[model samples]
Target chain A: MQRLIVWSLAGLILVPAAWAGGDKKNGNDKVFKIEGTLAKDDPADKLRKNPHKVHEYKMKAGANYVIDMITKNAQELDPYLRLEDSAGKNLAEDDDGGGFPNARIIFKAPKDDTYRIIATAFKGVGDYTLTVRVASEAQSILEQLKESLGTKQKELFKQFPAAKTEEARQKITDRFYELTADSLLPLSEFAQKYADDPAAKEAKNMVRNNLRQLEQSDSPGVGKVLRTLREKGPKEMHGQVSLALSQNLRSQYERSYQRKDKDAGKLLKEIEDLLKHVGENHADLASQVKDVQFTLKNLTVGRPAMEIEAEDLDTKTFKLSDYRGKVVVIDFWGHW
Target chain B: MYPHERSLVKRLENSPFALIGVNSDQDREKLKKTLEDEKITWRSFWNGPKGTGGPISAAWHVQSWPTIYVLDGDGVIRYRNVRGEAMDRAVDELLKELEAKKK
Candidate 1:
């Protein structure tokens, strides 16, 4: 069974690489195409430092467009796609949105104007096919939502790399959540309505991810959304949604309990019942269920910090318990 | 962050406060140079060759860089992921509490 699992996992990893060579359809709406090559030693501009090709296209206001830059023949080339208005204001930029290393941008044109589409290789030299098309009318709702959410996501991705401090990164992230706070209901509705659409899977993921972040930041919308999802979300989502809702409650209970709120006990009961329900009904998420339970019982605030004994920079032993009577800060830090 | 941390370490030099690190630099030798150049005086546990995926961070279930857990004098965790001024306040409060107990 273990060997079978390993092979299957390997197959899953290889699938996207295989698709790199295969022709991909940009949904069913064709508008225009540009084929270009980016070579090393090409002039670097203020907009993009990488070797790139630029094309200009006129876009209509309120129209949704799907832009894909897929590398041809060269698997080593990782394409980065960007869309900017004529004045060089960045509208949307993407890396790896078109599967493994390709780039896709779902953009909703804000005005009727000439837009510049810049195609560049993030790594290697390659010939790439850039396809621009209308986001099909049949999938208009999902496309519209994606374009709206994608803009903020693109901005975050663009700024995140240059963020020097944790505070700056948190500011960008908090802005994203603030911008998309109202998206949970609309996205959840989309996921439920289009249960079988490939994009629906993404929608569900966005909801889950946003919920997890909301829980962490203790956002006000978290409780309302969790309760709504638990009470009325799609049946297939019940298992995971219940788990998310329980986690939301657990965090709230932790806070209120810390403050000695009278409602803390009642909230704890609700959390326990929801967790038990998830465990009993969601066999597929068994491990995740156990993780939530473990965190609740062991890793919560006021619990004794877990002990650590390890080698320091010089291979000498270092232990957390050694500084027993001192207030300590364990910083899990890294530099890349 | 390093400059801020340097000042923080200096300020808390005489207090019962220790800021420990689990360093996730892939190259230990390079990190040794950085420690000296950056003037990092605190001791740091090596996170091994796997860097961010090393044993210590993996065991702590840390998903992001610079995950922080502030523990009180008795080694009970009191705060998490607090940074900058918030981290300073947490450490000060705990230190003050410890001093009161000593009296």
Candidate 2:
């Protein structure tokens, strides 16, 4: 035969280009660029040292990658990113996106093999610069802008309860802040032009955490589109959008001090002017706004009950002023 | 919450009400097997194993998670975060204002 049919069509095109050149010479899907330095003896540095720098790759299935880390000591680390896979589940995670304290993860490989990437430090640590790329057309424009922003957020939540009026709910809250800034300003200009693509900083921090949960709605046009995205958003998400607008103005000052709502001291001076724009380097949100100003001055509702000793399961010690005359009802609870 | 405070502690077992619990569960045999499988006849307390800064939800500034208050018989706090049946109508209007201040 003609030389064994040209050597069986060159052994079926050299066996898939010698199995894709032996997975590009054994570096599986390649493109890593790791660099580390967390410290305090690595392994999740005990107590509060926060350290967890792991990395591994392989991936392939449908390709696309993007995992970035970066960190030029943004006020002592603070980065955090997680991926996991080889059975350890969790597929993606990030904190402070690549702003403030860097971390990113723009995945795709739903199958093919190994994954794991950890890199931690939500407080402080040091050096970093992870990076991984592959990025197929910025992961098909972030899966077509996350399937057209989940079909325009389910058609703006079905036109938000038929906008019954307040000028048709402020024109459906200005068309939900113009469909969340036309679906996150083109994924924040494709993550500032692939700023070392951690899936375009995870699709621009998932469109700024879904526009900070629609600016924690209490509606007036989502509080005037969160006061115009706190005067034009993205300064590394102004301290997580002013700590979610000071926890939605301390849950509307505890629902206007539990319905005695004559705007309870104007919602406690608008929660002390949103905890003075939450600054004092957020000492745990200024000790949770000084424990909500000591539970609005000693646990509200006509204050007074503040004692509580605790210890019963037969281990004695009681008190809450030992149920004085009686009509107590404390609760507090938890068995799980 | 423990079946509406175990049926308002058996409908205020003979009045002058009390129901104080606190608990935080750092596993004292799983809070004594959930206060003996939830029969929980009042008297609780515990709040340790560092939950909410232990020592009684950091001395009363408990910022939510089952925080329920309601004191009255001169103790003071009059209904903090009422619940089910508005916490049985604020303990039947503070046990009818401590039975009209004991006559």
Candidate 3:
């Protein structure tokens, strides 16, 4: 049994590498194709019995790529795709994001590194044709913004620790906001033009989410800049900016509770006031705000670890509280 | 991370320390095979087939992968989100407190 298992696993690992090598050898290939069928004993099949396959590609930093996995027969197979960095951090995952029963992901590579594209079936296993296409214009613009914003953010953070006076810190904060708004203007314009493109939409959403998170900074100038962006910047992003501001306020309220800040009550009241302005169209954001409120009621540090009962590989039941006499470390993880 | 965790589990095997895992893998057979292949003797709780949305992770509100939590002997969460040497130091201190209490 042990020998059989080792041989089977070795074959599984080697076959993909051999296929990838064959693709590279076929001249300068712009699009690479992977053809595979998931079987009952295949690793992908074992991962939920849906057949999951992993392909690796050497991707350049700042390059935008669209990955598509379409099954030959839509009636028999539905494809799911996930892109992960070298460290197994998931960049994106999609099911039915393309034409029905197919998968598509538009991603801008964060760094020049090897990335894994994981293809799987939602139900039954079948053959899939996976292709990677480069989007040149999108890639070029994304790369520029990524480089400039990264440098500016790094320079600002470096100065933040050394600034001794409130005025000096405020100046730094204002510059950081100015850099953000200036850099985001072009991308926002691109998104406005290419409203239907997933890559553009995703890029726009990322900037909005990041700006929302930045609203948590203690610098007073940060809020002023955010208000300026909302009032005077692109009209298309106004609703998004308002929602982000609400999220930022919600985050601040949560932090106050965690830090036992004296202004926790005031922050909570502010969050309530901000929520009123968050339009009804943002049901998702409203639900998230409620979730945060729920989290505030529970899940505080120093509280007793929540009681849990789960089965081990041996199918034996165990309770978390059963190990009360021993110090415990709980690791939440997935093999994939 | 797994290698360091394995060694830590072995080092504290005979002590009043337990390393419980809440695994989010969907397949039981694969997990069993991985455990045997990796020579992992520590017991791990199977979170369920839904991966991240598994009952345990959902109940605990785990926002990220490999979220580690350290609990004192009394089951109160003392430290969290610490890994590597920081995790080692925190666990060592907690064990000493447990030992001192026993005395």
lDDT of 2 by residue, B18-59 (tens): 888787777666667667897787887887777667877777
In candidate 1, residue A190 scores what lDDT?
Answer: 89
Candidate 1 lDDT by residue in tens digits, A16-83: 65455223432223357777888887666346578877888767778778889999965668888888
lDDT tens digits by residue: candidate 3, A134-163: 665755566567767879889899999999
Lowest summed lDDT window (length 10), candidate 1 chain A: A21-30
Clashing pairs in 2: A106-A199
TM-score of each: 0.71, 0.27, 0.47
- What is the Å distance of residue A257 in model 1 from its true position? 5.0
Which candidate achieves the best lDDT against the true structure? 1
Worst 10 residues of 2 chain A by lDDT: A21-30
Candidate 1 lDDT over residue span B1-103, tens digit each: 7887888899999999999999999898888778888899988899999998899887787888888888889988778788898899989988998999999
Candidates in descending TM-score order: 1, 3, 2
Q: What is the C-alpha lDDT of each candidate?
A: 0.79, 0.70, 0.73
* Candidates 1 and 3, the one with greater lDDT: 1
